[model samples]
Target: MKNVLVTGFDPFGGESVNPALEAVKCLAHLKTETYAVEVREMPTVFGKALDCLYAAIEQVKPDLVICVGQAGGRPQMTVERVAINVNDARIPDNEGNQPIDTPVVPGGPVGYWSTLPIKAIVQELNRQGVPAAVSHTAGTFVCNHVFYGLMHYIAESKAAIRGGFIHIPYLPEQAARQPGQPSMALETIVKGLKIAIDVAVELEEDIVTMGGQIS
Candidate 1:
């Protein structure tokens, strides 16, 4: 069975349950004849996020890596298109560190495009009655930092790891506190992620050979 490494962040922004972790955990239970899944949690802080992500990638040596994060106001699972080299956090991270207009990695490329088949994944989710879209920005927060770091490592290393990031919406309970915040059902988010992983692993061969075929 082929191995896939999935990552989600620990809770941040005073929230107790992050949908990212919950959704990925749901998908982790899927058993297949030819594929095995492993889900892990990473810190949401700038300095620690990348290190944790790298460690997972190295240990799992997965054929595909999908990083998930919380995007509170979104109404669906968003397949992020790009990760920019900037850290402009709206609030302090879990470690109480906030950076403004700083490079994710000094002297690295200005940005990195997601290696996942975003459109295909979104289409599959929508077919299952789950909301999904191709998000152009993963934001300047820790999500983007981890995304950029994963891409950077893939570019430099000889390891055959395909990486991308996904942003999930707020849980129903989280939105209840904020009168106007958009929220999605945890089950729907889980279903969307499962389809995403299946698509990611199924298309691994084409992804490696075609190189950035997602549009």
Candidate 2:
């Protein structure tokens, strides 16, 4: 059976509850016949996020890793297609570090494509009536920082592991304060995540489809 490590960031940006974290916590005891799932809680800080992720990787030695983060105002579960090496945080991280125009890894590749079957996961989620799509950008915040760092580690170590990032919308309570901002139910988010994990563990290649955006 394959081993999969799923990670979610702690609440950040003045939020009390992060949907990603809550959903991941719910999945901690998930059992499947083909693969075992492990959950890790990562700080929303830039550098420390990667540190926590790396430690979990070393401990879990997972075959696949899916790092999840909360993306306020987003209406769907976006499976990121690529992770840029830049960190241009519009707001400070949980540690109060607001880095602008900084490279996640000095002299590293400009970006890294996700090794996960992103399209397949999106397709499966959509088929299950969950709002999901392939997102081209993970944004230049701690989310991207962790995503880029994870992919870079895999490249540098040449490990046989597939890793990617997913962004989830805010929870219903979170949007209640924002008035018009969209938020998904916690149970729905958890259902989507479970489907995403299933597709990631079972599908080896991504399915080609029309999951793109236009300016």
Model number with the top TM-score: 2
Q: How far out, in Å, is residue 5 in model 1? A: 0.7
Q: Looking at model 2, which ten-residue stretch has the lowest summed lDDT?
A: 206-215
lDDT value, residue 122 of candidate 1:
81
RMSD after Cα superposition, model 2: 0.8
Q: What's the TM-score of each model vs. the native?
A: 0.92, 0.98
Which residue pairs of candidate 2 clash?
Answer: none
Per-candidate Cα lDDT values, in order, are 0.85, 0.93
Worst 10 residues of 1 by lDDT: 204-213
Model 1: lDDT to the true structure: 0.85
lDDT of 1 by residue, 1-215 (tens): 77888898989989898888887887774678867888998888998988888888878888888999999888878898899999999999999999999999899999998888887888778878988877888999999999999999998896777889999889989999998999998888877888888888777432222113365
Error of 2 at 125 (Å): 0.7
